[model samples]
Target chain A: MGARRLAEMQVEVTVFATLRKYLPDLPVGGSKYIKVDPGATPADLIQILGLPADEVKIVIRNHVITELDEIVEDGDRIAFAPAIAGG
Target chain B: MTRKIVRINMSNQKATYEDVPKKWAKWGGRGMTSAIVFEEIPPTCHPLGPNNKVVIAPGWVTGTPAAPSSGRTSFGGKSPLTGTIKESNAGGLSGQKIAKLGLAAIILEGTPAKDQWYYLVITKDGVEFKDASDLMGKGMYEIDEILWKDYPKTAVIGIGQAGEMKLSNAGISVNDPENKPGRYAGRGGLGAVLGARGIKAIVIDDAGGPGVDIANKELFEKGRKNLTEAIQEHALTKKDGGLNAYGTDVLMNIVNEAGGLPTRNFSAGQFEGAAKISGEAIAEVVEKRDGKGMTGHGCHPGCIIQCSNIYPDESGEALVSCLEYETAWALGANCGIDNLDIIARMTRECNDLGLDTIEAGNSIAIAMEGGLLEFGDAEGALKLFNEIRNKTPMGRILGQGVEATAKAFGVHRVPTVKGQSMPAYEPRAIKGIGVTYATSTMGADHTSGYTIAPEIAGVSGKLDPLTDEGKADLSLAFQASTAFIDSSGYCLFIAFPILDIQTGFEGMVDTVAGVMGIDLTGDDAIALGKEVLKMERLFNERAGFTKEDDRLPEFMRYEKLPPHDVVWSMTDEELDKVFAWVHED
Candidate 1:
C-alpha cells in the first residue's frame, strides 16, 4: 500500500482590532481561507498564523464565540480580535 | 488663588463675575456643573423655562497640559429631552481657553426678555453682549466663519437652526482644532436650553489670560510623564493601533462580529454591510485619495491619542472631521444604510445644524419603521435633514427626538430610555451596557458607564457579553470610575490603559493630587466619583424619577435581537443594585 494521505480542510479566517496587524495584506474585515489537515483547531490556526495567544482575547467560529482549542470543520469562519472598547 | 465664576443673566442682559464658592473648591467639570444645577435649579421647573440654568465648566486638570486629553468641557442642565440632570462633555479649544481665563464655570441663567438674539464675547477683560441678528438663522459653519473673522484666536461655542428652533435633539457645537464647528457637547438637548436663553454663541479669547496654576509642578510632571508613556506604549492607544490608524470606527468589525452592533433600529444585532463602513475602509479611502484627508487628527489641541480623522469625498474635498464609532453605528448600521459617504454627509449636516447625531439617527430609524421612509434609503435620510433645516412641521416633530418621532408616526418599537435616544450598542447583546442605559442619570448615554470595555472588548477583564452574572457590579465600578475620569477632563478612551495598567491609574490620581495640592489615592478618586453620582441621583429623585424609570423599554425586554436571539435579560432588581452604594447608608 502507498503512504496514506491525510485529507485537508479549508477554513476562512478574519482578524480584527490589533490582530489585523498579523495579516497586513488583508484589509479590515477581509477574510483569508487557509487549508489545514483534518481535525485542525483554532489553536492550530493560531500557531499556523503566528498570532500571540495573549493578544487574541476573542475567537468566534461561525458567529459563535469559541475556544482556542475547539476543533474546526471545513468552511468554518473564524475571527480574532485584541482587547478593544468603544461605545 | 480663587477661580472666578462668570454668570450671565439673559433675562436682564447682564454678566457678573464672582469668586468661586468655597463649597465648589473640590468640584470641577461634571462634578462642578452637576453641583451647581442641583443646588440652584428647581427640580419641577421646565427645562427650557427661565428657572433652568446651563452650567459650563472645565475639569481641574484642564488647560494645564497635565494630561494629553485634559481639554474636555462639561455642559450640564436639566435636560428637556429626559427631564433629568444632564452632563455632556466635549473636546475642543473651548475648555482650555475657559480654564486659562481663570473661570471655573460660565453659567447662563434665566430666559431672554425679548425675541432678539445676542452673542457673548468673553475675554480676559470682560464679556460683551453683542446683537446677533445677522447670525439668527445661519448654520454653525456660517456662524463660525463670521465669528472667526473678528475673533480669529477665540474658541467659538454656538448653536444652529435646530437650537434656534429649540429642538430637544439639538446640541451645542464647539470649534475643533481646525476652527471647524465639528466638536459638540452632544447630548441631553443642552443646546435647546442655551437656545431658550436666546444666546446664539459664546466667543472665548484667552490671550494674555491667567493660565492654570499647578501646586506641585514636580509631581505633576512625573505623573504626566508616566501617563504619556503608558498611553504611548499601550497596544490600543499607541501610534499604529486601532485608534490612531483608523479612528474609533475600527470598532465596527469587532462589534459586528461579536453580535452587538445595533442594526435596523435595534431590530437586529448584526448588519450585513458593516464591513463597508469599517474604519479600515475609511483609512483605505483616505490613503487612496490624499489631500486634506488624513487620520491621526486631534479634536482638541493637546490630545496625544489622535483618534479623530478627516474624511474626504470622491473628489478629495473634505466632508467631515471625526466620523466616530457612535455616529458610524447610529447612522450607518442602525439605519440599515451601509454607505460611508452618506453617513459622512449626515454627520456633517447634524454638526452644521447643531443636532445630536445619535438622536437624529435614532429618530430617522423610527421614521423608517413608521413608513415615512424606507430602511436603507440614504437619499430619504438626506432629505429629512433638509426638512429639519427648513423647520417644517414633520421636521419639528422629528426634531423633538426619537420618542416624539415614534409617537407621531405610531411606531411602538422605539429604542430609547428616559426619552433620550440610545447610542450605538444594542442592549440585548451587551447586557452590562444595557444596565448602564437603564440606570444612567443622563438617560441612554454610553459614556456614563462604558462597560463595553470589559464586557465586549476585554479592556479590563473578560466578561461574557451574553451573561448577566456580575454585570451589575461591573457596571457600578465602571460608572464610578468613569464619573471620576469625566471629572478629570480626560478622554474616556484613556480608560482602556488605565484599567489594565496600574501605573496609569495611579498616574492619573497623582496628576489630580498634584494639581490640587491635596493627597489623593485611587480610592479617593473613586469616592469623588461616587459623590458626583449621588448628587446627580438626588437631582433625578427630586425630579420624580423612581425605580420604575430605571428600565429598558418594554420591547427590549421581550423582543429578541437576531444572531444571539438574546433579550435584555438583566432584571430590574439587578439594575437597582447599580446604586446600592446610595442605599447602603
Candidate 2:
C-alpha cells in the first residue's frame, strides 16, 4: 500500500532568485510539478530538485515557511528563495 | 582641515560658508541634517514656509572607499506630508561630490523675496546663485540634460514640476553615477520646501576639491579592507549575491512567497502577478534586450554591491535607470497592474516629475480606492501622471500625497501612519515592520527601520511574521541600528551583512571612528542613534504629534488581510513600548 501511494504522489515546486539556477529549465518566477515518493519531506524534494542546501535560504510550503523535516503531501505547493532582503 | 557649512539664504539671495560647529563636528549625513533642522527650524513652522529650512549633509564615510555602498546623502526638514521631522536619504553622486567639496552641510534657508527661480553653483572656489528663471516648469530629466551639458563634471540636485507646484509628495532628484536624473532623496515633501526657497537646482562640482580628510589612514584602511572582504564573502551582497545578480527586485518573489507583499493598495497580502514583475524577470528582460540596458549597475561610484539596474525598451534604448522592489511593488502590485513596461514608465514619470514613487503610487492607489479610476488601469494611471505634469487642480490634490488624496475622495481604507503612506510591506502580515511604521520618527518609512530583514528575509534571525511576541524589541533594535547606519552615510543595505556578521558591524563602527578620530563601540553607536531619535522625537512632540499619531490606519485594525488572515495585532500599549528606552533616559 505504501509503494502504491508513493507511485501516486506528486508536488509542485517553485524556485526564485539565485535558486532558479538549480532548476535550469525553469524560467524566473516559473514553477514545475514534480513527482515524489509518498510522505516525502521537503529535504527529499530539495534533493529531487537538485538544489544545494547552502544556497536555499528559506522554503515555503502552502504559503507558510516550513522546515526540511516537514512532510510534503501530494499536490503541496512549495517555493524556495536565496538570501535576499530589500524595502 | 575643518569642514565648512554652506548656508544659502534665499530671503537675502546670498550664500555664505561658515566653519562647522564644534558640537556637530562628529555628526554627518542624517545626524548632521537632523541636528541642524532640529536646532534651527521651528517645530510648528509651516513646512513649505520660510521658517522651515532644508538641510543636506553627506555621511561620515562618504567620498571615501570605506564601503561599497557608502554614498548616501541625507535631506532633512519639517515634512509637509507627515507634519514631523524627517531625514530622507538617497544613493547618488550628490553625497560623494558634496563630501569631496569639504562641506559638512548645505542649509537652504529663508524663502525667496521674489517668485523667480535660481540655481546654486557650488565648486571648490565658492557658491553662486545663477539665473534659472528660464529653467522653471521643466522636468528633472530635461533639467539634468541641460545642467550636464553645461556642468559635465558636476552632480545636479534639482526638483521637477511637482516641486515647482509645491506639492507635498514632491521629491528632490539627484543625478546618478550616469548623470541621469534617477536617484531621489525622495520623501517628506522636502522638495516642496526647496521649491518654496525658489531654488531650481544646486550643481555640486568636486573638481580640484579637497576630498574627505581621514584622521587615521592606517586604521581606516584596515576597516575598509575588512568590510570589503565581508561584503564580497556574503551570499546576499557579494558579486553573485541575489542583489547584485538581479537587483533589489529580487525581494519581490521572496516577499510574495512569504505572503507579505502588499497588493492592490494594501488590500491583499499577495499578488498573483508578483513573479511577472520580479527582479529575476527584470534581469531576464534586460538580458533579452541588451543594448544600453544592463543589470548589476551601481548608483554611485565605489559601490561594490551593484544592486541597481537599467531597464530598456524593446528597441534597446534606456527607459529607466532602476526598477527597485518598492517602486515595482507600489506601482505594479499595489495598483493591480502587472505589466513591467507600464510600471517602468510610471517609475520614469515619477522620477522626471520629482515625485516620490512610493507616495505617488500610494496616492494613485487611493484614487482607485475612491472610485476615481479602476484598479489595474494602466492608461488611467498614465493620464493621472499627465495631470500631475500639467498641475491641474485634481492633479495638485493627488500630488499632495496619499493622505490628501484619501481626504479628498473620502477613502477609508487608506494605508498610512503619521499621514505618510506605507511602503510595499503589508503590515498585517509582517507585524514587526508594522510596529516600525507606527512608531518610527520619520512616519511610515521602511528604511528608518527595516524589520523585514529578520522577520521575512531571515538576515539576522528568523521571526514568525504572524506572531506579535518580541516584535517591539526587534523594531526598537532595528530602528536604533538603522539610525546609526543612516548617519554613517553607508547604504542601509549594508545592514544585511552587518547584522549576520559581527566583524562586519565592528568594521563599520571602526571605519566611522577612524574617519572621525574617535573611539566607538557598538554600544556607543546605538547610543548615538538614540540621541538622534531623541532630538527628532522632541521636535515632533513640540510640533504637536502625540502617541495617538503612532498608529496604523483604522481599517488595518479591523480588516483581516488574506492568505495570512492576520490583522494588525499590535496594541497601543505595545506601540508605546517601542521608544521606551528614550523615556527611560
The candidate that achieves the highest TM-score relative to the unseen native structure? 2
Against the native complex, each candidate's DockQ, computed on alpha carbons, is 0.60, 0.80
lDDT by residue (B85-204, candidate 1, tens digit) is: 999999988999999999999999977767878999999999899999999989998998899999996899999999999999989999997888878998989999999999999999
lDDT for every model?
0.88, 0.89
lDDT of 2 by residue, B460-526 (tens): 9898888899999999898888889999999998889888888888888889988989989999999
Each model's interface RMSD (Å)?
1.7, 0.9
Estimate, for each residue in A1-87, the C-alpha lDDT of model 2 and write its tens digit: 876764777889999888887788997667889888777898888888889988888888988877878988878999888889876
Candidate 1: residue B459 Cα off by (Å): 0.7
DockQ: which candidate is best?
Answer: 2
